[model samples]
Structure formats: structure tokens, C-alpha cells
Target: MKLSDLAESQILKAQAEGQFDKLKGAGKPLNLTADGGSAEAIGFRIMAEAGAVPREIDLQKAVQEQALVLKETEGEDARKRELKKLADLQMRLEMEREARRRFFGE
Candidate 1:
């Protein structure tokens, strides 16, 4: 059978018989072929391959974390400080989202 027809490129008997059990990175995903040809897209793909997460996502996570902290904060002074932090994070997240929407029209 052609390799493409193989189950993720593994024969069931070979897989179950532990033939590939000791191979490096077994059971892990392989990088499939990509179709992007533009330089910008290639740059983006390289950045993604290098584990770059977008600023918008980071800001969103920050907002969530700040909100959680605000929930657990005690005392009026501490609560006020936490609220301010949460507000700042939320503002940043909103700004990032707005920028993305303006640029991408999403």
C-alpha cells in the first residue's frame, strides 16, 4: 500500500508490535506540507514554528489572570489596586483586539 494510505504512516501490526515504540518522537505529530509561498506568510510560519504567540492572545490571558486576582484580593486598598490592574489589562486587550479587527476586518 502507498505510504499516504497508512494510518498516519503506520501499519497497525507494526504499531501494535512495538516496532516504532522506541523511535524518537514516536506518537508525536509531524509537520505537514505547507502551501504558503509569499514571503510574509513564510515569515509568519517561521515565527509560528518558533512558538510565537500573538500579543492579543497574551493580553487576553493577562486580563483573565488579573480578573482572577481581583476576585481573590482582600481589603479596600488591595481590591482597588487589583481592580486597576484588571482594568489596565482589559484595556490593553481591547486595544489589541481593535487593532487586529481594523487590520484584518474580523
Candidate 2:
């Protein structure tokens, strides 16, 4: 094989073997509190700005229907609110995944 092909194969092999796993950006050990909001809030804000959610509710009804239902013991009202939020998030995630698939023609 050519040198380029050999190098590519070695890189792929190392990736498959998890040799590069430690290089992943797992972030700092310290919980730096310089930011005003939580990391999760920042991430969600980015996702929202990127138009991750479907514009129409009908387009996401199928995904929302499959969202997990919280137990009754968790307090019906609170559970209901959480479940609704989870369903909305799930539907948005599903829409984003579909958009990515279409973009990549996967």
C-alpha cells in the first residue's frame, strides 16, 4: 500500500483501539464558576439558536408520543411538567438528527 494509505490505516486502527480516547476534550477538572449560567443552559441556548427544533408541532408529534412518561409517585403535576419538557427536548433532538442525516445524505 501507499505511504498515505498506510498512515490512514494506522490512524483508523488507533481510533478503533481507543488509543486517542484520552485526547478527547473532557474539559477541565475544576468547576469554574466564571459563567453566569450553567453549562447545560449554554448548550441548550446554542442548540435553540441553531434552529434545532422543528417549526411545526405536527412534524414532531410522532417523536413526542414516544417520549418517556414519568411515574405517578414522582408527583403528578411535577411529573407532567417534566414529561412535557422532556418530550419537547426529545422531539427537537430527533429533528436535529434528521436534519444532520439529510445534510450528510446518510
Candidate 3:
């Protein structure tokens, strides 16, 4: 059989086996905003729901977490390391944000 046919058969078999029966938000409406944004917004929502955020967003999250840890840290060396990490994440996030803004003119 052709490759597409084989892929379809595999997907059908998985469905028959209930492999996708208990996914998160399985029966809930998607939490998309009603602002009628671009298709890119829809794709971003889907990717976020799947825990696949863009690098800038991910870096921002990391920076937040690192800030929390830095606050709780007590040792001098550890604090320095955490500070360096936070700075690096912040720089990367800035770069990614600028790139996205340039590409999308946003």
C-alpha cells in the first residue's frame, strides 16, 4: 500500500483502540478569544494548549522561575549563578521578542 494509506490505517487502528479517548480538555470548548485575530493567533493557541509555546514565551517563563529561585537562594555562589542565568534568559527573550516584532511588524 501507499504511505498515506498506511498512515491512515495506523491512525484508524489507534482510534479503534481508544488511544486518544482521555486527552486533556477532550470535551471542553477551546479557550480561544473572540477578537477575530489572525490565523497565527489560532495556531498559537493550539500550540500553547499542547505545551508548545514559542521560545520567547518559554524564556520569559524560565526567567520568572529563576527569579523566584534567586529570591529563595542563600549562598553567594548560587545567587551569582542564578543571577547570571536570569540575565541570559532575559537577553535571549529580548532578542526573540525583537525578531518576532520585526518579522510580524507588531
Candidate 4:
């Protein structure tokens, strides 16, 4: 059999054996022959070698995470504002106490 046929057969065998379980890093180029001149054959061989292309995202999980992140962001902002308001009130009270003490000489 030709080298192309052998590579094709190996790919099929791998697929049948559940060996092409992932395509994460399979986008890298592959050389199936020594001379490496058959572009079309190499492309086909790579496609067959990598059973299926990897997906970019899991839509449901991505949406849920985005919503959770937004919720945490808003919550943090609210907490920050509350803390600033409390600090301002405390400073004002301290100033008022100081002014009263100065007036009363205590």
C-alpha cells in the first residue's frame, strides 16, 4: 500500500480505537511522509488523525460564570461605597467632637 494509504489506515485505526480523543494541541502541523511534498494528502491525513476539532467554549458555563462575575463586581462596588460613607461619617463626628472639646476647654 502507498504511504498515504498507510497513514489513512492508521488514522482510521486510531479513531476506531478511540485514540483521537482530543484535538486541543493537534492544530500543529504534521509530516506524514519523508519527502513531504504531498500537501493535499498531508492535509487529509491530519484531518483524519485528529478526529474532531476542539470547541472554543462551553456556552452555558461561560454565561453562568459571566453572570457570577458581574454579580461579584457589583457587590464589591456597593461594599466599597458603604465603607467610604462610613469613614466620612466617622471623620465628621471626630471633627465635631474636637470642636466641642475646644469650645468647652476639656
Best by TM-score: 3
Candidate 1 residue pairs in backbone clash? none
User: By TM-score, highest first, what's the ranking?
Assistant: 3, 1, 2, 4
Decide which is better by TM-score, 1 or 3.
3
Off by over 4 Å in 1: 1-49
Cα lDDT tens digits, model 1, 10-106, are 5676678887577544577543445345554554554455466778767878888888899999999999999999988888888987886676566
After superposition, the stretches of candidate 4 with alpha carbons farther than 4 Å from their true spots are: 1-74
Where does candidate 4 clash, by residue pair? none
- Scored by lDDT, the top model is 3
lDDT of 1: 0.72
Off by over 4 Å in 3: 1-43
lDDT of 4 by residue, 2-94 (tens): 766897998899889977666644556565564276654554455555553212123334445544554555577776765565555556556
| Per-model CA lDDT versus the true structure | 0.72, 0.58, 0.80, 0.56
* lDDT rank order: 3, 1, 2, 4
Deviation of model 4 at 15, angstroms = 99
Shift of residue 4 alpha carbon in model 4, Å: 99
Q: Give, for candidate 4, the lowest lDDT window spanning 10 residues.
A: 52-61
lDDT of 4: 0.56
Q: Candidate 2's residue-wise lDDT over 8-69, tens digit each?
A: 99879978998656642334442335334566444444345445543433345544554534
